[model samples]
Target: MDFTRLSSVLTVVGALMLPFAPASAATLTFEDLNSGQASYDVVPSPYKGFAFSGWFYGPDTVYAPASGSIDLFTDYADPTDPGAYVITSNNAITSAVEFVFDGAAFSGYSGVTFELWDAGNLVATSDSLPDSQGAAPYGPTFLASGYSGLVDKVVVSGVQGYFSMDDFTYHAPASNNVPEPGSLALVLFGLGIGGLSARRRR
Candidate 1:
């Protein structure tokens, strides 16, 4: 009947009833692609995390602005271009997409832009690609995260020339995996034992 003891018991009960949280976000780097799929030679048919409507996948060093062998490249050329690229994720709710890009990969290259859409509704967009003018052969890296709302598709577009995007990283919604029935039972049992012990001590 003690107020403090009752408060403690209620807190314990609330904690015990909390559901187990599990990771729900996933990332795709395209490293799983084989040699036949490198250098933008062929699109990764039915790639996981997101579906590709129009895009090129390759290890073209000329596009990726990072050091070492550019293993993968996501080219977002002119919207009018036949090979324009669009990515969509249907398996899970997408949250963010972070990738490296080189706006000046080729001549007439002005800048780049990207957009996030959920169920055909535009949710987020990168209006102007940052003008880093990367040094030497590589361009600058950019990380875009903390997107609001759920995203299902992403579209990358360039101004004049083609924009080279590499290391496409997409984030899915965070979810706490539900604990196994046995695990939950054990946890509940432990909490009950602790609660009984506390009551006896009082």
Candidate 2:
């Protein structure tokens, strides 16, 4: 075949492969934790496979010993006044609860999108937590992708002073394309022609 014809065929082949290359599918879900401090647990109902867990702390307070129960002192009290209601701990106070999941085991997803609702202001470890803090909720939302293997943990701190977490969730990509034998046969046929054309051009 002439070089011009060969180039035209190669361009067509490249166009065909474009759709199958890396594509981003962003999705999210939310699981509510009704007024409680608990370790991670699987989300119920529509989102059963995903799991989430976290704890709350007051200013200058240590986490409670119990796993799935809320501690009013550490979980509800205000970090500034101690006598008042503080959702997240003071910045000076470091320890906070962590929530994590095995992305591969649970949903076969590579990453997650996290959203937090704190009645008070929150200081996220990963991103700069939004500064505006009040009874009205405010937090950051972003994509987490590119995983070598299963994702073990995702930590969100500052549950004490003005920070609180209402809902945590995980999302899976929609398409799981595993080609059937017939589809593979078609691809192989195209590849064979492509190989012969490549050899002739050489």
CA lDDT scores, all candidates in order: 0.48, 0.35
Q: Write the per-residue lDDT of candidate 2 for residues 87-139, one digit (tens) a residue.
A: 33221211132223211101100122222322233322333344334533332
Q: What stretches of model 2 exceed 4 Å from their correct place?
A: 1-28, 31-47, 55-125, 130-149, 164-202
- Model 1 lDDT, full chain set: 0.48
Query: Which prediction has the highest lDDT against the true structure?
Result: 1
The clash numbers for all candidates, in the given order, read 9, 12
> TM-score for all predictions?
0.53, 0.32
- Ten residues in sequence with the least summed lDDT for candidate 2: 102-111
Q: Which stretches of candidate 1 lie over 4 Å from their true place?
A: 1-25, 36-39, 65-110, 132-140, 175-202
Over the stretch 1-202, how does candidate 1's per-residue lDDT look in tens digits? 5567667867976775554442233444455664644335545555663456545556554445433333333443443464553432221223234322212122123355566676678767654555336443335455453364556666655432244444555433433455678997787688667777888897
Judge candidate 2 at residue 188 and give its lDDT: 60
